[model samples]
Target: MNDSDDDFSRFAWHTAEQRAAQGDSRQVADLAVELTHRIEAAAEQTRDHEHQLAHLVRVLAITPGHDSLTQLLRLFTRSQGPGVGLAPRFVASLLAEHREAADLVGPLSERDPKGRLDELRICLLHELILRGVDVDAFPKTIDWTRVKYGDHPLVWLPRRRSPLETRVVFPSRAINSSAHPGGSVLPKEGRLDPPTPRTQERSALVDTATLDLHQMIVSAPEAGGWGHSEAWVFRADEEVEPDRVPALLPTLPMGCVEGLGATSRFEIARRPADEIWSLLFATASIGIGHDGAHGAFGRLWAWKSLAALSDAPADASAEEVEHHVQQTTWFHFESDAEWFCNEIFADYGIAALSPDRRRIAVLAATATD
Candidate 1:
């Protein structure tokens, strides 16, 4: 390495990261461009290449777009600590944040044949969706199991409206208010008839997805301990209205809010169905809770929960996921009322009516103390 490279290796990038953290967007972008040059020009056969790449990977957080994504992926292998698996998350975030990164996902299995990029693949899909790109429109990458969710793309084009094959019973109002302090649609009796066949089937899928979420595989994050999640299903007596779900949800029984008075009351607001996955993925995403790879549990849970709710097979595709979500009438809720509370922050949930409106699935999670 030359004297200037030595100066950068010893002092420059650290200050770059510090400046980036201190709100220097220009410095971050400039550092990313510089690091890409240094890392790319270094030969893989060079004795110090991996060492140089490993130490400099930390600067990725300073910027995105022109960050040394592909180069770093090929050269870096070490982590700051054992079991950290920090590289994939950084690569994933860099990919998601980079304006030109969307093209990288279509060739998953070959690019990451050993599955090193799994979680990043999932997050990139998410970020692209947020950008309003039609991910299902991407060319079929045949037989790559996990990214497909379990199937090939099916809902790439909007299907003509048809009565759904799956159905659920419409809920009766246990609480009538949609204002501050929402009310439950659960019966005052606080119980339902025996579990329906639909419940058993969806639960089986959920259980299986849950198991995968708990695995300590490369790039896949474990189940999160920072929040509480639960599922409750009820048979509807009438047609369930999706817009009214914020009031009809069984928030009290779901432990989303404390029921202190004679009636269960908490404030709740509905979020767009397309938006919930990102909102859930955002929980505890920075600083100590989600340092690099560790904070990934949130995204895993978000992906798994929605997939399970749709009864999506392990190989289900993004298009099919879109179809199922459209078939199902679901509400994603955000609340700050005293009754709608998490251990340390606001609580949110999904109250979904099975396609036929015969079964209602209510799933909720709240950050804990």
Candidate 2:
């Protein structure tokens, strides 16, 4: 092995040996947490992630518990989906032996889980279940096997008005302002909580996971240029009352939208649901495709995100998502609307009413050069 690899391996094992010899559980745990950042930083700098992660997993497997695992997840709150590279297999394997490893799940609001670290955590959670973690171990709120509300966000299919009329799942991460180009893009108190419109279910069991698209968002070098990611789900129940389908949603940007107001500008008219979701997947950059030779990581996240976020079965497919979307009327926001050319919103976005007509999932994104 190279000098750096030897250094990494030696440092991890030596530290573990020293801590274990001293019989200090707290020291071991603290070192475990510290190593995540150290190894992660080394991996990023040397671009040698696989080997680094293997060593990290080896080191952490010896020190298992609720705190270390919980802290490990907190690291994902800011990741952008595919970029975070810890291997889920090792973590899952460790969790299998330690019953308490998956005990705590960070609040979704805390991390807003945009990348693969969250995905990896989810895969570990699912694997832990497979490894004998009790099915009852997870909260009733997070049904990893079921895709609730709609795809991409909201694991449970709560009543339509809930997210809109409920309390903020996450504290206002930011105050509203036109200067930052508000709307569904940046986090607001009433806006759907980060990752999904979680007005009603802000307290998601322990507040945790799901996301992976059935179709790929034909990727481009600049399509998902570095930027912020946001998603929301709103519902009014198509099977209910006197036509209040579009439920008054929070402020929305006008890039993909044409008119000045949100009400009638980006209207829908029943198009193929999957087609539109492809657009959302593209803009949201769900399941990024950059994984060396293992095909695209998007496909992996599709099922992993599903398993991680809900109780929905592992085999949930795109057709089913379409079945739900097609049940309503969906349409695309054209490129000819009033502010369709706005620079801020111009990066990317998908504003379509779910096929149920009872909800609208507004996903807005911004890209920087």
Candidate 3:
């Protein structure tokens, strides 16, 4: 080897050994990138190229730096032959980051064969969700199965059970409130029934909205866990005027807020007022759930019914009110109302409006009278 190449090899080896011994992942990643370059250059002349490359891959796999992981993935794609396998553990680790997994989607898909590509993508998706990516953005048709992460097989997605036969019972005051024009048009018990199946394709706009909502929800401190009962209710009246929505909603100087684990950025889409309202309601109440359940489905129907109620006259009948409430109810049992209020509503200035557009209810578990 030439003097310059020999010097580089020596430096790479020394750095790798030092960083590995110290367990410095960032420094190890840096050294791994340098070694990758050396390995590529010496591919034709060096007999030790495979050993060097293997070491580089191993270091990069364990490194927490996303840039280093990306470089390693790119190198693996370029250098490894078709028959060779990329390390599943390495791929899984890198995919634990939302941005990294998203970046890999196209490249991994293009490089690996169909079945292998699907497997890798599935693994990446699984990790992304676990890391708090929005559930609404997940691919709808996932054939879930366990893949080996190390010695153990890991399940990325579990099959959901059949929808529950349930109803949403509104508070007596809320049912009798002028928010519903028709007197007691709802069931005698003031409950909203479950929604019918929807055949319409979800809009891409809704997808974007859902992603934002997911980020906001997951970033909140108290968002995760089962049986969270906190909720907020807000209302906006037609007399308020559509142009005032921005002023009425919360505003952050840069449209971003920092919470417990991650920073959340939000933007209200410039759509018609009604469309925007519906989109936000649907995305927040139903689409943000980690899994499909009766609660989410019921919330979707409830929002739709609320929209219909907004159009009904104030003197609407009990049956009419019941019909609307039954059309929509809370579906997400795991929803964090405090998180929604603090992170979503408080940050974004969102208020939930009654069907008549006369009242906004901000229900939250943390709310104090």
Candidate 4:
């Protein structure tokens, strides 16, 4: 099919997989059964009933749990008359009498490899965070080999020969924009510098003790006609400890400071931290796919922003929350610099001053012109 069709199919498949992954097995099963009936009904009108009937049978066979088995049998036995042949009866008998159907049909054992890997990574990271493992230590515990090369056939030989050597190695040093700031297409002027040694050290400490740190820069409207922006950094599922924050503030690279602190003129208000560690983990794992590669820093920053602000609802599923964060981040990045500065800061309770006596006439002329 065409690219758009392929995309739509992939999206639908992913959506279904996501629903199934989120412990909604019953809902998925029900939907599958409903679709099977609809297809079967349509097959009756068409000349190619055999293929559609077989497809329906396959659907029933694969559906998990005893409830699905019962539904399958009921659908088969109820449609025994007329053109409905011995195939349904045979399948129904096999399902009803023996354990073969039970063995064949069960909960989803296999899944999309990439999706499964993502889930495993998120879970692994969550467990590591809970156990107070250092962020630096993450590279050691998780199998990057499986993540990067396990599924690809090209590296299969090397993986089979020496899995350790084949594994993708993450750099020991903090990601530095000066060295490799990701894709060439990215705007260099807006890029943040690499993490300083001090920042890296503190980040490790925070990761080991609490949660991962994330930083984002947004332009903020200032007094006069000019707009200035500063980096807003915060930890996932953590509050800014008044005593500790001051010392750590300097560790960040130049122009990288807490958004609230700078906007409130260093008089930031106290807010309790939200339990959004899962949301953070999900967002970080699903980075924005750019230049055929995903940037880790961007994902982390998005995660941190969502977590720090407690933007996701507690009841929302992990997939839903991640989608929301990603959509918001994409929009923010796409917005004009000035609009983003004014809107985001204001939403987060940061005050921006209106332009003073400096240029109403100029502004008026510019607006009119």
Candidate with best TM-score: 1
TM-score for all models, in order of appearance: 0.47, 0.31, 0.23, 0.20
lDDT against the true structure, each candidate: 0.43, 0.36, 0.35, 0.30
Candidate 3 residue runs with Cα over 4 Å from true position: 1-55, 58-71, 74-85, 97-101, 114-119, 135-156, 159-369
For residues 1-118, what per-residue lDDT tens digits would candidate 3 score against the true structure? 2337676667666766776778877766765677777778787556476556556665565455557656766664554342145544334433443145455444454434324334
Model 2 regions more than 4 Å off: 1-45, 48-226, 237-271, 280-295, 300-319, 334-346
Q: Name the better of 2 and 4 by lDDT.
A: 2
> Which lDDT value does model 1 have at 117?
46
lDDT of 1 by residue, 20-92 (tens): 7789878567656777876766654454755554346544423343335544444332333311344545444
Model 3, position 6, has a per-residue lDDT of 71
TM-score of 3: 0.23
Candidate 2, residue 117: lDDT: 46
Model 3 worst lDDT window (10 residues): 178-187
lDDT of 4 by residue, 55-121 (tens): 6664564455666655554453355341154243223222322333224223212232433332223
Judged by lDDT, which candidate is best? 1
Give Cα distance to truth, residue 27, candidate 4, Å: 56
Give residue 78's error in model 3 in angstroms: 5.7
